[model samples]
Structure formats: structure tokens, C-alpha cells
Target: MTAPVLEIALLQVRPGQTPAFEAAFAQAQSLIAGMPGYVRHDLQRCLEDDHRYALLVWWETLEAHTVGFRGSPQYQEWRALLHHFYDPFPTVEHFVDVTPGRLPPS
Candidate 1:
């Protein structure tokens, strides 16, 4: 298994708040994309469950996110854009992409 290297944040917006959620999320994405060691982030909306959204984030390491990104000025923007959309704090989990196929061909 690879070292635990990815931080996953799963978010669920309040019902009927998708538009507001997206507006904030877009602003955050713009800010976070510019940070060092911030590799990628993608957002998904649920068709079956309208209030559900998924935020998939990849970074060089967990420290790059929790320490570097959150510690930077850019994090304020990230917070402003995303914090209110959540009905509650997000469920955060960390795991490595350890599947033989989950990792890039090497």
C-alpha cells in the first residue's frame, strides 16, 4: 500500500442550495487551483440526490493541503467560498491510491 497521501472531503449542501453552493465553490476553486502542491480538484453534482455534491481533491501530500494550503492567505478565499455551503462540517478522510491500477503506470 502507498503511504496515506490524499485527503478527501465529501460535502452535502442543504436542500435547494445547489446554486448558492456552486457559486461559492467556483470562487474557492479559483483560489485553491493556484496554490503550491495543489494538484487537482473536481466537483460533481448528484442527479439522484439533488443536495449531494462530491469534492475530489488531489495534492502532493496531506501536509500540502492541511499545512501549506490551509495556512496560506488563499485559504481565506477557499473558506469564504465553501464554508457556508455545508449544512455541517464536511466528512474528511485520507487514503492512498494503493490499488495497482489506482497508481499511474510506473
Candidate 2:
């Protein structure tokens, strides 16, 4: 099946809260990694704007992301741990990878 593409936001925690945010994110990673159909994930820090960050997650299908992941217990943990880090929950969008690059080797 063709994979679904999702853009995730890595909420910018204020400077002093970096440690707290990282610690929580580290804890959530294990749970997220265990979910079904979860293909891969990447964390990126903004080079031009240090305060900004993002997560890119690819799934085997949209259901794998919205229903499988978002509705699972792991998602609860993921949200509880990470949601607060965002000053304002950044926007989330989905798109097709028409001219995609090489699939990342996990």
C-alpha cells in the first residue's frame, strides 16, 4: 500500500524548559516506536530559528496514523508527554509525496 505522509510539529518549548521537554519526549519515543503501521519518524530543529522544531512521520496508510496511532494508548502517552511543550499547538497537515526522495533506511 502507498504510504501516508504527515507533518508533525515539535512544539518549541521555551529555553529554560528544554530539559523538561526533552526528558518527556525521550519517554514518549518508546511508546510511539511500538505502534503498528508506524513506518518512520524524524526530529528536526530549525536552523534559521532555533526556537522552532518539527517531527516528520510516515505511515503505511492514513488510518495507520489517524486511527491506529491517534486512537491507541500509545497516542495518549504521546500527547500527554508532548502536547504541553507547544506554546500554541502548531498546525498539522498531510500531503502526497509525488516527487519523494529515497525512503529512509531504518
Candidate 3:
């Protein structure tokens, strides 16, 4: 079996738009959840920065996200719903488990 990959994105929302952005994300998440190879995901808000958020997504493989999700028509809908909230846009990175079981499931 292929080990899962984690996708991390640091999202910075426009000033005073955190609530709206969160609401939009709540709706947008289902799109990702239904995708092939999707495992799970989380959205976390920074303690010191209300407008900053972190998105962590797990997939069965990197291609599950980079190609399967991003290349699909649903991705365009995902972008339309949530992309505008970012100021400079978020940079996404992928990571592998340094030690298996170090991170617990959510």
C-alpha cells in the first residue's frame, strides 16, 4: 500500500474576512472530501493572527491532489469559492511521515 502524503497550505485571508472565508471553506471542504484518494483534512486558525489559517490535507498519493483534485472541474468551483480571500495566495507543500504514527488522526 502507498503511504499517505500530507498537503499543507498557509492561507492568509483579507482583513476582516476571516468569518466569510471560514464559512466558504466549510462549504468547499466537501468538494475535496469526495475526491478520490482523499483521506482527511483540517483547518486551523492561528492564535495571534485571526486572518491567517492553515490547511492540512491527507491523500493516498501526491498525484491525488496535484493532479486528481487540481485538474478536475470541481477545482474550478473550489477556486471560485475560496481563492479570492487570499491576499497573496497560499503556497502549498507536500510532506511525508518522518515517523509513522507520530501524528494522530483527527
Instruction: Point to the candidate with the largest lDDT.
Output: 3
- Put down candidate 1 lDDT per residue, 11-104, tens digits, no spaces: 8898788898888787678787887877777788878888887788778778888899889999887887778778778987767676764655
Which residue pairs show backbone clashes in model 3?
none
Total clashes in model 2, counting residue pairs 3 or more apart in sequence or in different chains: 0
Model 1 Cα displacement at 100 (Å)?
Answer: 2.7
* Winner by lDDT between candidate 2 and candidate 1: 1
Tell me the TM-score of model 2: 0.81
Candidates 1 and 3 compared: the better one by TM-score is 3
lDDT of 2 by residue, 41-71 (tens): 8777789767677878877777777889889
Q: After superposition, which runs of candidate 1 have C-alpha atoms over 4 Å from their true positions?
A: 1-4, 101-106
In the range 1-106, model 3's lDDT, one tens digit per residue, is 6568999999999999998999999999999999999999999999999899999999999999999999998899999999999998999999988786575444
| Cα-lDDT of candidate 2 | 0.75
Model 2 spans with C-alpha error above 4 angstroms: 100-106
TM-score: the better of candidates 1 and 2: 1
Ranked candidates (TM-score, high to low): 3, 1, 2
